[model samples]
Target: MRLKQGSLLWYLYLDKSYCLLSVRNVKALVEYFHLLDVHGKNTLNDVLFYHFLHHVTDLKKRQINLVFDMLDWSAVGEIGFEQFYVLVCILLAHQNHLEEQFMYRHSRTVFDLLDLKGDLRIGPKNFEMYRFLFNIQKQELKDLFRDFDITGDHRLNYQEFKLYTIVRINKLQKRQKKTEENAERERSLCSRKCRIK
Candidate 1:
């Protein structure tokens, strides 16, 4: 799969990491490494690496510095393939672990925003107040509320709301994956035709 610009693969590339060698395209990886090796030294200095982290990721300054230190294992202000590979593995694992926590906390935040009354449940009245926040019609909102209110209580508790949001996100992700697959297929066919010509 061709990694998107903001995906984890791109981050690894930005770090000039070799950890992605097993999973990413060789040509793309080589191009990315060359892009980061600005001084033609075949290595990333502190300044260049900092610029990479600053531009490619939204990580905080502390986190960026931590990653930089991790990659510069020898404290010589330069990183090699082994350091990059290890950093990539650590970052990927950390991100995967945080994803679930982030999703759960985000769902709670959304549910709290929707449940304005502090009643631990989102009823039609509270849901109506947030209608302007959504693009769906009133009827659609009602139907959604009904579907989310799994216990037939005419209200959605935090758990029900969280589940509903997760399901919705999963559905959207599936659709996005299907679209991306179709686009990749089209690109492959075009490339084949070009080669034939």
Candidate 2:
């Protein structure tokens, strides 16, 4: 996946090399990935991956299969630690509603998974359809395109999409915080007062 230094993909696979994280943490992650290589083939087959996904994420059977197929970019029945690690990042980011943040930073991997066509660019509709992979509904996608299509060409290349994801995620977080604040206010005794027309 190009493996550029300091990139998200690079961080996932080579943070140990760079010594960017704790040595113990890196060892733990490496050991976990190795342990999943139950047959010692240095690759994970469907069974191992299925159990991994089943425990960590809410993906249905069909969705899990689809994810496996995509990660099996070689069309082989097994995938190495690099592929497995990419899936791990995807699942964690998705569970936290951070798809855009992860995708924007790891555009190459994200584009490979979601480009749908080999066209090197994507429209908001693509986001709408495939965002379900992250278990996210169609929130503000079209509006994002309309608002952030800075080139005015109605499609997002990697850089533009990165900017879009950052903005969209920031807005989502803001909305979530606002919702939490409003809920807190609603539960407060002083909030018993209501306005009447």
Candidate 3:
């Protein structure tokens, strides 16, 4: 996967040397690098790389193995700091891109599957098929369909469905932000009380 230009990871990769130097704790990074170099060879062998990945990500064993295969481009059975940094940036960027692509593809696929008549809209008859795919209650489905239909035509078009998803995502993000702010405030209050005590 090509890294998107102007992305955070791409910028970091472009000036990795400067970024590394700007780190607040260069000693910690160097220590971490040595820890991953299990054989003390200033590089991570497959075993050390596996442990390093496990420490950094919650990826499954198979997924970690796949990453290992991809990053070991030199066929040298070991990885250096540069290779590790590049692989990390690429994977992070790839994951972000994949999430966006997946959401778009998934929505399109679901619309195609549910729009049985190929009429670019899902009507009552076609919506029956949607019930099998989604475990939503019938009344909830009706309410959602009504809300998403947008034109009040009693049918959901792809554009309308996409708009609904966008609105839902925005609302969810707002709620999540509010929740985080509340948690931070509580933490701040607790810390202040502890300091006072």
Candidate 4:
């Protein structure tokens, strides 16, 4: 239950004990985690670890909860390598991104999914995917620099580019989080209603 240094290495050996019905899903999750580890070398800082549930795959969470729900397995509310692997498997089995998208679009699913409203709280307006890379390149910046030149001078400095990138990422994250929260809230309400009814 407790994650330690040899966690991942140990899991590699132990996972063979359980027979998973869908091996492909397991492989996909494993690959996903591999990529995550590679890319998150720097991005997976202490902050990410502290909020590690965000990164966990659905499969992994169940395993952790079942095993370590009673124990303080995650000291900082974060799962380490072995715990991460278990969660990833659980995520693949239960967490359906497509389903989440559908629920968000059709109706806000829960507070953790998306917040369609302007409010930071979770709601339905958040799950719409309007952009494809091609659409972005074709429509939004068609002229690219038509209005970018503040003084009618056609050029962008390093500072301008840096600031733009920062602003863009922050905006996107905020919007996404809003949508996620909305969907999550909707889902929660639905479940509660179901239980009550």
Judging by lDDT against the true structure, name the best candidate.
2
Best by TM-score: 2
Mark the 10 consecutive residues where model 1 has the least summed lDDT. Answer: 12-21
Minimum summed lDDT over a 10-residue window in model 2 is located at 1-10
For model 2, the superposed segments whose C-alpha errors exceed 4 Å read: 1-23, 123-129, 144-156, 170-197
Whole-model Cα lDDT of every candidate shown, in order: 0.59, 0.66, 0.59, 0.37
Stretches > 4 Å off in candidate 1: 1-105, 134-140
lDDT by residue (tens digit), candidate 2, 11-63: 34323122133555456666777887889998989889888676655567876
Report the lDDT tens digits of candidate 1 across residue range 1-197.
01236754555422222223355544554566678888887778877877766665566566566556545645688886555544444344234332222333356654665565567898887666544323335986677787888889899888887886677657656876999999999999999999999
RMSD of 4: 19.0
Native-vs-model 4 lDDT? 0.37
Error of 4 at 9 (Å): 24
lDDT of 3 by residue, 51-146 (tens): 766665555666566556545656688878766764553344344433222223346654664565567887866655434223335875677677
Each candidate: RMSD to true structure?
Answer: 14.3, 8.9, 14.1, 19.0
- Sliding window of 10 residues with minimal summed lDDT for model 3: 13-22
Higher-lDDT candidate of 1 and 2: 2
Candidate 3: deviation at residue 63, Å? 30
| C-alpha-based local distance difference test score of model 3 | 0.59
**Cα deviation of 65, candidate 3, in Å:** 34
Model 4, 73-155: lDDT tens per residue? 43444334555554333332222222222222222222222222324332111212211201224333333234332334443
lDDT of 2 at 63: 68
Poorest 10 consecutive residues by lDDT, candidate 4: 125-134
